[model samples]
Target: MSTLAYGCMGLGGGWDNNPVTRENINQAHQVVDTALEVGINLFDHADIYTLGKAEKAFGNVLAERPELREKMIIQSKCGIRFADNEGPKRYDFSAQWVSRSVDNILERLQTEYLDIFMLHRPDPLMELDEIADTLSVLKSSGKVRHFGVSNMNQHQISYLQSALDTPIVVNQIEISLAKLDWLEEGIMTGNADGRDINFTAGSLEYCRKKGIQLQSWGSLSQGLFSGRDVSHHPQHIQQTAELVRELAYKYNVASEAIVLAWLMRHPAKIQPVIGSTHLDRIKACAQAPLVTLSREDWYNLYASSRGQEMP
Candidate 1:
């Protein structure tokens, strides 16, 4: 399985109304170079990221270095539209939107076809048949090689997959030491207190059993021990940071490696989508694959993160 994926959300900095420029493109190239140096070959993008400048900056890299295209797996997502004066921010899974989004993504990424394409989020108003047909057309036309979804639950993925011949290969969701809901839902299962766990029941297990790739966002938990003052952090975060630091010292690696190793220790073979733009941070995160947490240490970190013992 792929060890990790680089997220382009932070590329082409500044989400203000400003348009992406050559400066952003240069910045993206630097980050991409650093990520490649760290052996991360998968790049993740969303149309709404940095107002679409993320893709443009990344595309600019490929335009300048066409050879880089074959060395990487580029994936992007669409269907999230901003709120205008007309209405609130919403999702669009309409056939027209999916078709047009793929075209725009290819143009911005300076690529002929995407290795994978995913819906940015679940579209409650989705017409499954229409979406299935749209995806069929895109796949048959050689626009997208594979399909996936982000922030979708098991039932939603099942329903969508049922209507399409192409399989949903990945499901990206927020998972980290700081975010315990994903694991808490299962750890607390069979107990009445588990009712409050809002994560979709059996979602993690479903993905694991179906061989669906589980890619995590916020995999580093926003830098638990990145020289920040943990005193001001929440009690649970403070505790988790302390434990991570201790484990890092014990394992002779950076704290990021400890956190990511905890997630990687799971049986699901999760591929974390790391968004760090700092070269040093990327290098530190690359050490994640080297750390092997024992079963006892892994649960200790989990209990520390959740501020309680596992059920």
Candidate 2:
């Protein structure tokens, strides 16, 4: 069984406005069941996800089915604060905020500890020593089993890693066929042409070297490969979708599976986080681990997605 993680961001209805309802709880329960049915053991959540409604709904289902907790690995993130009554939209890495966020995450998930707790984003003003000491305290107290960060570059992760004794287990970032910089960075190096690819500096190779599991968010690229409107999409997106669709037909799997399979094919072992709320789409995504793309096919997809053959 593939260890694809299910993202709960789109759960509990709309974000910033709609509070989690009983209907949302019911939907969450169904989604969780579907995820487990498809061998997805990891559930990803963030404190800001739907204003915590995602975790609330998840907690509701777990409250009813406490047994299911043993069958899953629960992870949640913090450090991102929206501009409501607070100062402005910002990232807070203060020990106090991290502690409080974990408390709320635990309460909403109806759990004693999170398998993994991540900083949602890098706070420019983060105090390394203070954050490290704080995370060490949390780990010792058994509030969080492991630590990580999201949307962080290699240097940011390196700075954090330098302070902590525990390893940063994962780095979740936006990665998809549509977002090709991870691949482009290595390809463009030492070339005279010097393509302008704004990838996080050496983060992909760094993660591979450090054994940090790379978890991909926005993994499906908003379903561009899964029958999203080709007419409205860019020419490259259309070409990428076409190639993905052709591969899907050849591999006898859904187009989403092909898209995700491409990510999984990377040597870094990138885990794609699926956020689809639709049951059928979720099931289709589960087929990703089953499809293995050949070397030729993988490069073809990459070249097609890049809208040009390699130089």
TM-score of every candidate: 0.97, 0.97
The C-alpha lDDT values of all candidates are: 0.89, 0.91
Model 2 TM-score (2 dp): 0.97
Can you tell me which runs of candidate 2 are displaced by over 4 Å? Answer: 192-195
Question: lDDT tens string, model 1, 1-311?
Answer: 24989999998768977887888888888888888887889999998888888898899999999999988999999999899896799999999989999999999999999999999899889998999999999999999999999999999999999998978999999999888889988877788988887799899999988889999998987786544678987897788888889999999998888888999999998888899888888888888999889999999999888887876
**RMSD (Å) per prediction:** 1.3, 1.3
Candidate 2 structure lDDT? 0.91
TM-score for candidate 1, residues paired by index: 0.97
Which prediction has the highest lDDT against the true structure? 2
